[model samples]
Target: MNNIFVYCEVTEERSIADVSLELLSKGRKLADDLKVKLEAVVMGHKVTKLEALLYPFGVDVIHYADDEKLFPYTTLPHTAVIIELFKKEQPGIVLFGATSIGRDLAPRVASALRCGLTADCTSLEIGDHFDNKTQTEYKNLLYQIRPAFGGNIIATIINPETRPQMATVREGVMKKEVYSVKYKGKLNKIDAKSILKDDDFAVTIIERHLEKSKIDIKNAQVVIAGGYGVGSKENFQLLFDLAEVLGAQVGASRAAVDAGFAEHERQVGQTGVTVRPKLYIACGISGAVQHRAGMDQSAQIISINTDINAPISHIADYTITGNVADVIPRMIKYYKKNSK
Candidate 1:
């Protein structure tokens, strides 16, 4: 185990994705535990500017692939170049953000190399394991932990036999931090054209429509979430008003999304995005296990619901028993009065 590689996903803005930076932060810890270098794999048409940003996150070596065909994320070319590099380097561990591009690319590369891949892992760590069936003691294995059975249980997966243990982690599941000192590591430029053939590019991109999303609850420091108890779509406006005053992002449970009270991107749960905000105010939420799996890790939880027996109240740091409509307005008023 020489190096731990993070697949750095570049955004359309010609910047490194926040999830990749988060992975780099976690990978640095893993690399330190294994006594190995933390490396990053960055591929884009013109990603020269993105290379420098990775060092602050504690990247030791950057395997960079810059070429025209690599833009806009076509499956074949990106997969081909990564597979070629993996074959050559044979990294000890590889991590990918469980985003659209990462979900598409990781499985293909794992399949091509005949390696195991754990998708949508919420936790990753290095440890020792004992295989009872094989009677083998595996040391320094990457533990890929995720929610299983619809977030009712957690499962830890290990690829003991694979050379490069791989896992895809969702954004915001891990914290991101920069090292105190900048990493002066090696940057190896890879020639994408050398390994990529004309036939490898089966899919052609005619045009790219990049829509700017307004909501990013995963990165929000304070999240105010609603559930089916919020009632109708119109009543969801209460959440928005509360969020506005609190300077928090609005989140919803799976029930809220399914009931057409909110968008899927605004959903926070096992089936949706996992969030670890500094403050989580769960209003009108029943606190199902699925919903808790996503936000139970918040630093502080304030559950506001009429039902004292709601599952959310059990884990919440503060439980407010009241109607969301009645409670939110008073809170907003108090906040305004106190601030003034």
Candidate 2:
């Protein structure tokens, strides 16, 4: 209960990932509630420069492991560094972003330490629970909340017995905020060379191809999502047109993705990426429970569907009853005319 640690993932651009900062922002609140310090575990080669970014996000101390072998994120060395740090520090709560690297590393470390790990958590909080069976009270437990049963129900998981409660949160599930300038923190450099050995690296990365992605729906300020009602792959262009006018990204429900109307990466739902955009325009989507679980957290929802009784209408801030093809062109025209 001394410190809350966040595993900061460094990008190939030598910058800290946005998800890491988001975790730190949430971890800060948890640390405050627990009266503990908020710490971050940063690992990469020449990553000392990125420490400055961690300070504003409520990080009190940084456990840094800077080494060439740490870059590109091989499982063994990175896991070794994290495991060694956990053994030495014994942090209270450890958080990881449910990204590719986080998903891979968290389970390994949790298994090694014989601790419990909650994956794809949407929300986290500190609270107490009364065990009626034991007639016992557990205080200050980390509540790992996530969608369960194919997003039909929500489940809150707790690791009451574990020393360092661990959870992997999907990106964009939490908001990122910076503390006031009055707050400042310190960093502690770790020697990873001594802890790692030649045999530890069972796998090697001969070459790495970093492809720049075209769509970043998770971080988009405005997202326009389509479903089966959008019709065919060619008709999906209507979504793109609206998105271009709004300076937004295009997203699709699992149905649209599966029907070949959109690429899998453009999917937004339980089986796909979760988004909490400022404005979510769900066009032609029925708002299935699975899709709702991903985007129901948006600040504002505008659902457009011909069916007045569409499930999305229940959660939508504004419901437009119309065909997407007919409605979208008019919207684009109105925006273009008004802006001019």
Provide the clashing-pair count of each candidate structure.
Answer: 0, 0
- Which whole-number lDDT from 0 to 100 does residue 112 have in model 1? 96
The residue ranges of model 1 lying beyond 4 angstroms of the native Cα positions read 219-221, 333-339
Q: What range of 10 consecutive residues in model 1 has the weakest lDDT sum?
A: 45-54
What CA RMSD would candidate 1 show? 2.0
lDDT of each: 0.89, 0.89
lDDT of 1 by residue, 1-340 (tens): 4489999998888778888999999999999899999999998877746656888888888988988788878899999999988988899999999888999999999999999999888789999999999899999999998878766788999998987899998877778898745567779999999989988888898888888677899889999999999888888898899899989999999899999999989989766788989999998999877788789999999999999999899999999999888898898999899995
Candidate 2 lDDT, tens digit per residue, 1-340? 4489999999988888888988999999999899999999999988646656888888889888888888879899998999989998999899999888999999999999999999988789999999999898999999998778866688999987777899998777778899754567887999999999997799998988887677799889999999998998887999999999999999999899989999988888765778988999999999887788789989999988999999899999999999999899998999899995
- The worst-scoring run of ten residues by lDDT in candidate 2 lies at 47-56
| After superposition, candidate 2 runs with Cα above 4 Å error | 218-221, 269-278, 297-299, 333-339
